[model samples]
Target: SQTIHQWPATLVQPVGSPLSLECTVEGTSNPNLYWYRQAAGRGLQLLFYSVGIGQISSEVPQNLSASRPQDRQFILSSKKLLLSDSGFYLCAWSPLGGRQPQHFGDGTRLSIL
Candidate 1:
């Protein structure tokens, strides 16, 4: 059985601060990882994705960046967060070849003050 974990279920930070969010998966290997953000009333927007270790694909141009250093660990980082960076961040995983639907972890609600 595969499961995903994300930390700091809720976060509050001042504008122009640094941000780091981590996600890890268990019971799977080399699964595709994705980072998505959902704004207050907007649909989900893909931030980044990884097919394997050290391989990442960015879907949007923003203050966010993603890295996959290990087989099951994905990290999202921002050196200088912006007010627009506040949103619900989600980490998801899927099987290879885009054949499986992604399973998402309970997201982190981020608020910029």
Candidate 2:
């Protein structure tokens, strides 16, 4: 079975500050990875997706970027934070191919001050 580890379960940052959140998967190879944000009691907003290392697709126009530096690692970064960016950020992975159920990690709650 695969496991994802996401760090900093809670974060508080001021607007215009830089941010970096990381996620790494274990016991899986070449899995599809994703990042999304969800406001409390709202639908998910996809941020980024990766099929493999160095392959990333942005799902929304925002101040954030994602990178897959290794097969099992994904990182989300922002050069500047926005007030609207406060939400629940999640890391998830699915087995290769399509239509598979994605497994999510404990998400990070970001608050922009």
The TM-score obtained by model 1 is: 0.97
- Residue ranges of candidate 1 with Cα displaced over 4 Å: none
The lDDT, on a scale of 0 to 1, for candidate 1 is 0.94
TM-score of each: 0.97, 0.97
What is the Cα-based lDDT of residue 14 in candidate 2? 99
lDDT of 1 by residue, 1-113 (tens): 99999987999999989999999999998899999999989899999999999999999988889999899999999998999999999999999876889999999999999
48 in model 2: Cα distance from truth in Å?
0.6
> Which residue runs does candidate 2 get wrong by more than 4 Å?
none
lDDT of each: 0.94, 0.95
- Best by lDDT, which number? 2
